[model samples]
Target: MRDTALGAPNGAALPASDVSAAVGLVGLAGLLAWIAICRSFPEFVGAFDLALPAERLDGPYAALTGLIAAGLPMVLWSVFVDKVHTRDSTGLDWNKRAEGQSTRAISFTKLTGLWATWAIIAAVYCIARWYWEGNYLFAMQILGVAIVPMVVLSVPYILWLDRRMFQPRDGAWHFGAFLLAREPWDREKIIGHWRAWIIKGFFGAFMISILPGGFTQVVNADFGLLASQPGALASALIALLFVIDVQIGTVGYITTMRPLDSHIRSGNPFLAGWLAALLCYPPVNYGLMSAGGLLDYEINAPGWQHWLAGNSMLLSLWGGWMVVLTAVYAWATVAFGLRFSNLTYRGVITNGPYRFTRHPAYVAKNLFWWSASLPFLVTSGGPMEALRNVVALSLVSGIYYWRARTEEAHLLREDAKYREYHAWMAQHGVVTAPLVALGRAIGRGRGEVLQPAE
Candidate 1:
């Protein structure tokens, strides 16, 4: 019922998450360290009375540097502590590298597939009108600069990586074989190859486009003043959490290297999965959930901040709760470490918030939306307006529920460990156990018993 990454085997006992709780904290520590540096660097120079620029480092580039600060430490932790590079999941054999010459022919075909995938993604970026506008323009510019280097460097990267892989005729090679029509290719693998790239290209650009805005907001905020105003303080805290999310999420999208054992094992191949995810982003989200969109829920709602004004206690409590929800959402991403992405399975993670519930991020997020939006309390229009707002927001929640289901379905099919974890959670998870019991009670009322996992 829940999506998971690497974890223990099936048992009556709750399984442990393969990723330790410390991994996310390590990344968070790195990010906080960079933030501290950014805030204090100018002051440090001024204290020394040196002839340095002595300017604040709260620019977009500094925000980008935060990703490096966060990512490099996590990479080190993964390699040195977790020894993730040696995992069977990585498909790497460091001690026994394959003779490079033997795999060159295969590498050539894989390179063709990889390069062709990049071209198609670039062309799509070109065709999409939105990519040339607003923040997407930043993403396009970054990608444009990266394209030449990516093309030139992929030659050695693919060749080198393939030499160490146990069996290197992966999905990319199959896609290349299909393109050339000179070798046999698995239809499913080709489809899979396309699916993985589509997830990467689309989400990668979206994540990068959003990176700077939240970061800038946090970096530029006046914390001293915000602390006096609950609403403003909550907004600042939420922005900071989102900045953490975007920064770590961008790293997850970009760091899909086999050496890190964080490569996408498979994209969710289901059309339903893709549709559910796509509806939550960009042009689709604009059409379906934006201000003028069909499912727009904020039509005349004044929101919690408006209704709770002057009630200091309520404002403080509400704001604090919202911050907690956003923090949980951010923590979910942090727990993914370097493997977070939409519609893909890198591995199963049962640590962090996953120990309690399968979809902590989605659950916390929807709860936050309901509390913050207060759709039932409208400023204008009558009961009908409030009703419509509630329904619309409910449907939006439904979409997230749909996403959770599809993600679970995809993971359940891909990994047996997930199946074991799923069963264990049904019986033992603190949050999931009660939900599972209630579900069974309902099913029993209808004379339909739920079957146990095989």
Candidate 2:
């Protein structure tokens, strides 16, 4: 259940519009960083206490904008790749196929019932979590920022989109009403997504949590990117791109990941999912990164080097990698478009950033984390601390390494084409193949290939 992200010309890695979009995102990041540096917006030091009504709306509003942004590439896909206007892919053009259409029609009653059930569950979870030590205000905020957007705006918009793009001639396809409805679950679904709803809910809630502070960064005249001061430059980069990626990635996740590929074909091993999920959520994502009040929640990478001051040349280096890191994350996720998910193999992507490497997202992310951590050297810190940092950071990187390896193995086993693809990528990748071979050699060729079913 995947859609083609590319209508690329003759196996090209990127289309012309993609280049434009990438350039545009990067330019926007640079400008926003500059503004944050020049203006010192929102005064994050004062936190939400200083936020006005407009600033408060930034997060949820960003979610709206992100969904719109996700649609641009998708709309392009429709026009150029899918050519949906003149032809419907649901086989709706033939009125003679009512039986298949009948099976496809989502029951309005069932959909409404399921949504009501989920709504009640989500509300109860929100409320009970409050009693179980969740913040009441945060719960309310979740309702406003996350849940409300999903129900009132996001869900309906998607349903309408389904009606617009994939409607059957007899109007039998009601799966629009069943947008969040479950398809058939595979074994992998049993464990990796123990908290699927909560994760998605929070994932959606992130825009709500992040956007206002981003606006505040602008408002406070913390103007992001500026000349000369590397410290201010880094702050600006974090202040801006940090917000942008979440919007872009979240939109990608919702548009493609949630609606299109929620059904995981394979679950990652426990270690892979645990470590990745940990980095994605709380204390790790923000606790170590933030310098002040609302600053904590921003997606900005903290010190690649934990011991250094915020205003340091070392962190500036980390910032460069951070940019690469975020860009790669976006590239990989966007390539999947509608197939993005954590700890799951729903589809294989061969174009875009993926053409360069089999594990672009994990590789880029690990590089970013390592650069941020500044391990094995006393570049700005003592040897003991550096050594300790190296060990901890290495562990985190290792998790991703396992993720990449396991992901390949799982994908290869699941799809025969992916197996051929694995062989091809291993032979052809400019940078990744040799690196993978080297890793295999170091592991004594362990995990190099799967055994033939014992």
Candidate 3:
């Protein structure tokens, strides 16, 4: 009952968490409002890069296959793991009735309010995206029929789930955050403090949600090329890479390692961690990335050749390099496995692909993008213009590089292992040693301040 490491028995209420959640809820509402405003005034829509081409709907099949294949197993395994952890010695689910009553501070009203707010945001995004894709009638149906009823219907369900799965019953929270009264030791522990856990869950759900669409991309590309394309070998290799990525993701989340118990926490709450994480994900990217005038496949079927033009040899080479990058990316993920999630450290992974470079995924991913983009293929502009566009498109890689630095900073602060890893990578990494020296030289004017992290 006495105050201890985690918190006091009668722990002071987390007003800060409440405030942060409230701010998040309000910010989401405002984002929805922006979508609505853009929808109502089409002129304003041009100012924001919120539009996605209706034709791009053709999708990528091989990528989709990877996502569906990988995602289902992870979800199933996570559920199985949950069941195993929540069971008692006699094989019963741990009871939380008393714990739910006394230890819980979150009430029904709070949970419902948060969910309802999210419902509004979802409804707005559905309408905005559909409308952007020029499907006005479908957008209307979603608003008039689906969003209205779902918001109304979700209240009771939200209350039930929050109580059963999500509410913090003891000091620890379940992945589903269910209410329980047993010893906190028995509960499934998430990686961070309660606030950070909430943030991680938000992004984790984002990762799961994108799998189907990502898989569809692979399906589209592989099947689309199967009949007409000459480079069957390249296509097959690409498909294999997607499968590897899925496998790596599943491996990371299943570990029982001490550091891998929870994903990493956000070191910088604002720009470095959460904001950067959001920018890295999709739908969100549809809004943030369009402004950079970077090269992307926003054009439809016939028009894509204008931007994506290349001979079969070039295309096959591009596909091959992409697969190689995906392999490196998968290797990184395999080491990270279940610990893999954006903006939070589930744990520091120093083995596997990481020993060769601190950021295998980022490096490989950027190279794959460059290969696929083929900025050398000018679509409609002069050589100078094409070069400028390529440079701009390359900035996308810079964004990931920034993300890598931020992640390093976060891990370095939280785990001394990361600092050691950084030093070792600078001196001994197969791929990173040269870059490390160049980076230090770039900052040579600052005086010899780069010392080893002890």
If scored against the real structure, what TM-score would every candidate get?
0.94, 0.60, 0.54
User: Which pairs clash in the backbone of model 1?
Assistant: 4-348, 4-349, 5-347, 5-348, 5-349, 6-348, 6-349
lDDT by candidate, in order shown: 0.86, 0.48, 0.47
Better of 2 and 3 by TM-score: 2
* Segments of candidate 1 deviating more than 4 angstroms: 1-11, 48-54, 449-454
Runs in model 2 deviating more than 4 A are 1-66, 69-73, 76-81, 84-109, 120-124, 127-199, 206-208, 215-225, 256-280, 283-322, 376-382, 440-454
Clashes of 2: 31
- By lDDT rank, best first, the candidates go 1, 2, 3
Provide the lowest-lDDT 10-residue window in model 2: 1-10
**Candidate 3 segments exceeding 4 Å error:** 1-198, 214-240, 243-260, 263-270, 291-315, 445-454
Looking at candidate 3, what is the lDDT of residue 46? 45
Better of 1 and 2 by lDDT: 1
Residues 1-454 of candidate 2 have per-residue lDDT tens digits of 2112211122323212211234324423443443443233245534546544323224334334444544465545544554533432222232333343343333332335335545755676556543234233433554555655556564444343334333321111222233334543233333333344444454544443554455445435333235465556665655555555544555444543222322334455546544656564554555443343221221222344345556467656766667767677656665654445565565556677766777777777777666654455554446665665666566656656655665665675566556555555554566666765575566665744322110
lDDT, candidate 1, residue 94?
83
Q: Count the backbone clashes (under 3 Å) in each candidate.
A: 7, 31, 34
TM-score result, candidate 3: 0.54
